[model samples]
Target: MIEDDAAVRRGVVDALEYAGYRTLEAGDGDEGLRMALGASYRLLLLDLVMPGRDGFSILAELKKKRAGQPVIILSARGEEHDRVRGLELGADDYVMKPFSVRELLARVEAVLRRTCERAAPEDKRMIPGGEVDFSEGRIAFEDGVEEALSEREGELLRYLLEAKGRVVSRDEILRHVWGLDPAKTETRTLDMHIMHLRSKLRDKAQDFLVTVRGKGWRVVS
Candidate 1:
């Protein structure tokens, strides 16, 4: 959790702890940004308005470096723009301030549950001149070289492999991989990560991660 307000931060942390969830918190954006970038956590609870490096800025950085992270924004701003911008920046959910503890907890549970359900199964895939070991999170090439994958990249590849070569829409990718509703959010995060994954796999997006024109993407090979 990252909140500037002491009372709200304490209350939320207490509630989460009471509910059997362990949490790490920061009182300002700078600290939160450091923790967000370095720590290993299942979910992040962020405040939009902070002393420095606001949540939106933090979220943008996360999208670039940790796009698979699950995040929910807590903010006093209830304007359409605020909410829309958060979603566009790849936040999984947005909770307006003055929200009840009950409501907040419920949202937290829902997001976590959806994320858990999207967990990728263990498997390995054979690709051109190399093979991907999902369980090991690495690629073994014919030249005796290997490249490791980040957790997000592995999950993305796992999801694509699960599609069995069928075209999957961007909306479907968001729903299954990011656990966000495609209709409610606008983001190119999915496309960016897909491109990154292709580069890691040493395959062109058009060849391996096929663009289905008006649809989404498919792993053809």
Candidate 2:
């Protein structure tokens, strides 16, 4: 858990340990971000306001690098916008400051359970002009050319194809495919990935992957 307040951190850590959960603590955001990015943990408990590097910034980076990581925001900022922002940024749950230990633990358990129950996407799918083998991480075109797809590319295509015949919002794509909070500024990353996928799929005319203006994207069925 990454929290700046020492007394609160200590109390939470103690409570968690007593409940049979292992704990790691960081007093500041810089150290917290490093550990969050490098460490292997099931869930993260984060604080919003902190000295040097705030929780939101750290959360943004974490989502970009470790999209599937589950996070819960612990903050005194109980405003509606703050909660909405946290959720948009991919926080699985938000616990307000001055919360009960029991409630916090319950939230942790629920998030972990939900995360564990999520199923992995299918390993292979056939696109319009080619076949995408996610397990092989490559696209085999009908014309005998194969193009490699990065992990992110494969995920993007998989999500789009899964939602074929309907427009999938950019926010949905970011949250599901990129494991990011859609509220974070700018979707250039999503746009870039879409561009790359189009090129790799040889959809120069956008016949397979089409963009819906003011909405998101759809894989033509």
Candidate 3:
């Protein structure tokens, strides 16, 4: 946990400890960032407004170095933009200030559960027109054509294939694959990536990757 308010931080830490959780805490942004980057923890509780290094900076660094890190933002900034910004910076959830202990604990539990449920990524998968070798970042089509995949494209395809049977919401893809906030309106990038993936896979008919209107994308067998 990283919080500047001493009383608030102590209260939260005490509550978490009482609930059978061991915690490491910091009262300022610089120390918090250091601990956050170095400490081994299942989840991170971060304060957006802090002295020295703010939560946004720390979040950006984590996104670059530890894309899979689970983080929840705690802030008194209740504006929609603040929440959206935190999420866009790769926070898993946002908890506003003056929040209840119960609510905070519930958010923590939910984030931890979601993180734990993510399966290990696969290095290769068989697609419709070819086999995607994620390790090599390339696709081998049946007609003997080969296409290279950018790192982002490879990760996106791998995520979709992992959740093959169901429609994955755009927000979920953004959070899990791009580390972007799902609530952000700029999803054109995601759409473009999907289009590129489809082209690379030779899925012009959309038989392999199907977009469910008002929902998300799904990979069909």
Candidate 4:
């Protein structure tokens, strides 16, 4: 996860973990880039502005140093040129600040899903327990059991799995999963749902949720 605001960082990181993902976090573009390169993660969540390197420079370095990795820019750079420039500089996608969680998850999911299927075609999706088929939305666990998920859980899980390796943001989650318009409501509601999801899935596979300090959730390897 990459973000500057301290408050945003905490909320986002918690949400990402509760949602079942592993994450790496950075406060600015330079740190984001360093973490991105130093790690062998499947996804990169980047911020454009920073104390030193800035997002644009980071993107350039990411492309130059780690050509195969995919990048998603999360920043205040909502201007048209900024978006285009990010893409041109090898950023796979861009998300402006004050973004919607629904949109963020959707974009993150689309990028990771697409990339995995393209590069690791043979083992792209995880078939947990021979009962839990992530892509299929059906689980075939013990007792030869199989079931469908509620609409919201399905969406949340989908997004988590897609990134699978980085903390997702809270604003991103609320906007994306609940489609909640920005409001004054407490964020605790998200925690309840995550607990429920965690309880249900833990028995079937390796621990999925990892709480990244001051960041969001990620679904990692």
Q: lDDT winner among the candidates?
A: 3
Listed per model in order, the count of residue pairs whose N, CA or C atoms clash below 3 Å is 0, 1, 0, 21
State the lDDT of candidate 1 residue by residue for 81-111, as single tens digits: 9999999999999998888999999999999
Say which prediction, candidate 3 or candidate 4, comes out ahead on TM-score.
3
Clashes of 4: 21
Q: 1-221 in candidate 4: lDDT tens per residue?
A: 77777777767667666667688788876677667656546788777776777878887876654554688888776889989999999988887777766677788789988777754322224434434455565545565666655657667766666665766766457755676643434568776766666655653343566666565677755
| lDDT tens digits by residue: candidate 3, 6-90 | 9999999999999999999998989998788666678999998889899999999877555568999999998999899999999
User: Which sections of candidate 3 miss by over 4 Å?
Assistant: 119-221
Candidate 4 CA-lDDT value: 0.68
- Each model's TM-score? 0.61, 0.59, 0.57, 0.52
Better of 1 and 3 by lDDT: 3
The candidates, ranked best first by TM-score, are: 1, 2, 3, 4
Which candidate order results from sorting by lDDT in descending order? 3, 2, 1, 4
Lowest summed-lDDT stretch of 10 residues in model 1? 168-177
Q: Which candidate has the top score in TM-score?
A: 1
Whole-model Cα lDDT of every candidate shown, in order? 0.86, 0.86, 0.87, 0.68
Q: For all the candidates, what are their Cα RMSDs to the real structure?
A: 10.5, 7.8, 10.5, 14.0
